[model samples]
Target: MRRSPWATLAVLAFAQFIVVLDVTIVNVALPDIQTDLHFSAENLQWVISAYTLLFGGFLLLGGRMADLLGSRRVFVIGLALFGAMSLLAGLATSPGMLIGARAVQGLGGALLSPAALSILTVTFPHGRQRNIAMGVWGGLAGLGGTLGVVAGGLLVDSLDWRWVFFVNVPIVAVITVITPVFVRHVAAARAGDRAFDAAGAALGTTGLLAVVYGVVRAEPAGWSSPEVIGFLAAGVILLAAFVRVEARAKAPLVPLGLFRSRALSTSSIALGLNGAAFLSMFFLTSLYLQQVRGDSALAAGVHFLPMGGAAIAAAVLSTPLIQRFGTQRVQLGGAALGVAGLFLLMTADAHGGYATALLPGLLLFGTGIIGVGVPAQISAVVDVQRHEAGAASGVVTAFYQVGGALGLAIVTTLSLSRTNAAVAEGASHQQSLVDGFHRGLLIAAIVAAVNIAVTLASPQLTPDAELIAEAAAVA
Candidate 1:
């Protein structure tokens, strides 16, 4: 049966949307989750970190699996696991159960997201078709995070917090039923043709998980603490081992040579920096709106509507901008805007009203997000070989996840340290919190500025007309 390319895109995009949405949806429901689960303040953070650590850790392996096992097969399997875990999460009566379910949910996302993206890369021809498809995919990726906040608010207010997890069941059910009908399966690699680098996979996955775990733990434990230092050192050693293994392996899990592509490496770095700033923006602003401004969860979500709208608009504009100015220029421009937005946010004060102070910064930050995000995503895979698309996508996604974790840890630690100092000096609690948030916003601005510099310095940002032509020809 012939399947429409657009139909394939729809199925893939929907899957990506839900996967990304799950990342942020839990944020708004955290309070309720803690209350119901009787979670300690320290343990509460695991509800999120558990999911993130596994997701980032397994992403590369997931991408390779997509290539080895077939993208459609991996996608279906991932969706099934994600849906089942969502059910487990929603029915959980204790912190242990919910956190355990969340960890598996992250694994499902790791598999589903890359497979879905690899499918899109194959299904759509390069040039205008791929660009447009990526525009929609990138736009949805941004929208999903924003929408999760809104949806989480509504669901938590009207129903129970568990609805946030339960909501996935119906959506996943619909997508799962329709996916096989519209998405064509790519042929899996022959078993005899290539060796599966199990050693490389183990080293890389453990390395990433160790790094993410260390970063997450650093939020509660100081960076110099034994646990943080030990995990981080272990991560670095394991990753180094993985690189050595890849160089000698008959069939390496990650082709280290892919880093030679200036486009892929530079864009991956810029994306990581952007992820750090953008994800932290979401985290800081949500805290600012609720903690400092005294807004309810619902109100905070509503306030973000402007930012979401701005992001959607910027995403729509990204394709045309890329065509006219090229991906590099657009990305640099986006990073600049992000820096400007962060600067504006840093000016926020406890006394200021949301409309007066928060709205403009949110709008600019949101716009900046799509500007950097869409171009970075497109550039990550644009020059890669078709067969390596899954690996390329995984590298990009891994950077985004790890960058967010690392960046948030750094920013949060700095902010909280400052806040504690202020409180010790007898500052009001609200003022101290606001001051800390501003400090974090300042660091976020610096990160965005660094991204701009990186983007500007990369020669691969130049348009490759021949590459696009070759891709289209092959398609």
Candidate 2:
């Protein structure tokens, strides 16, 4: 059965938007939720991190499941679970209930995200059609993050915080109804014999959760504490074991050999680094605007409009630049822009004017992310076999989510360190917050710069460059 590419794209894109939307939507409402739920300061991040930890941890399994099960079946199942969990999240009466629901929601997201991408992978075969479809996919993913901040602020101000979760139901419902008519079902891969790698899945998920838990807890407890060290050590050993198991498994959750592709390997690193910086940008910036500048959530959302617009523009510009200069050049340039943006952001003071200090940095950051993200994503899955695309896409998404987990942990730790130092030195709360933000921004900037250097050094682009060189040799 034939599927309308348009309808399939819409379904997948919308699904992705919901998945990515959750990442930023909660940020604008964090303060409100805290006040109402009596959330402890340390526990505040878990509201977001819980979702990320589960989503990131299980993404590989989800991708593999899509490969084992049918994509259409997985898509529908994932959508239903996510929608139901979203509703549950909206109705939560306690912090534990909310966090539990969020973890479930992330589980649903883990299922849906890879399925959505797999659908896209199958719907558009290779060449121009696939490229165009991927562009839309990439664009929507970035757009979703920007829109989340805007939508979260609007909903929080106009109605209630619960509306953010409730909003997904209508969108998911619409897609659920339309997808069957528009998309065709594909059979599962090797349906009879292969059992899902339950043991591997357990080890991988537990390992990641422990690592993310330790990272997020760093700010609350000093890094040297036994608890932090224990969690980190256990996570590392478990993950190493998971890797070893994957090497020998008959059907590994993530194919260890996929990393053999230069394109895939470099792309994953680039995306991970891009995510590390990009994910933290909004959290830090929004906090600065609301806490220091005293902007309302709505006002902060509006303030981000330029950044959003710049990002959209940058994504639009990426295709042409990538075609002309190639992925390597474009990515390197984008990373440099990100570094510059972070440097500019660090120049902002508590009293700094928005126009002179803030907007420029926001614009640069937005542009950098768009430029890096799209190309990096394209490179990641470009070389994989058709059957392996789902697994490849899952790996890319996992890198992205884990990057967020790590980025948040680092930023939180730095913020706490700076804040503590300021307090010990007799600075006011507002002043300490400013100091923390400044330090965080600087650290993020340094990270971005290192990513830029790493991207420049990546061995993948060397092949493409060699291809060009060989062509010249023949000429």
Task: Please tell me which predicted candidate would have the highest TM-score against the true structure.
Answer: 2
Cα lDDT tens digits for candidate 2, 1-475: 6668878898788888889888888888877787788876556666787788788878878776777888888888888888998999889888898899898899889888877777876787765677667667766877888888889999989999888899999988988888788877867887575568767878887887788777767777778888888999999999999998888888788788999988778878777777778767777787788878888888888888888899899877776676677778888889999999988988888888999989999999989987787667666665666556556767777887777767776776776679779989999988998888888887788778877776776544323433322211111
Residue 165's lDDT in candidate 1: 95
lDDT (CA) per prediction: 0.80, 0.78
Please give each candidate's TM-score: 0.87, 0.90
Best by lDDT: 1
Query: Worst ten-residue run, lDDT, model 2?
Result: 466-475
**TM-score computed on alpha carbons, candidate 2:** 0.90
* Deviating ranges (above 4 Å) for candidate 1: 1-8, 34-46, 93-96, 118-139, 180-186, 219-221, 383-390, 460-475
In angstroms, the error of model 2 at 193 is 5.4
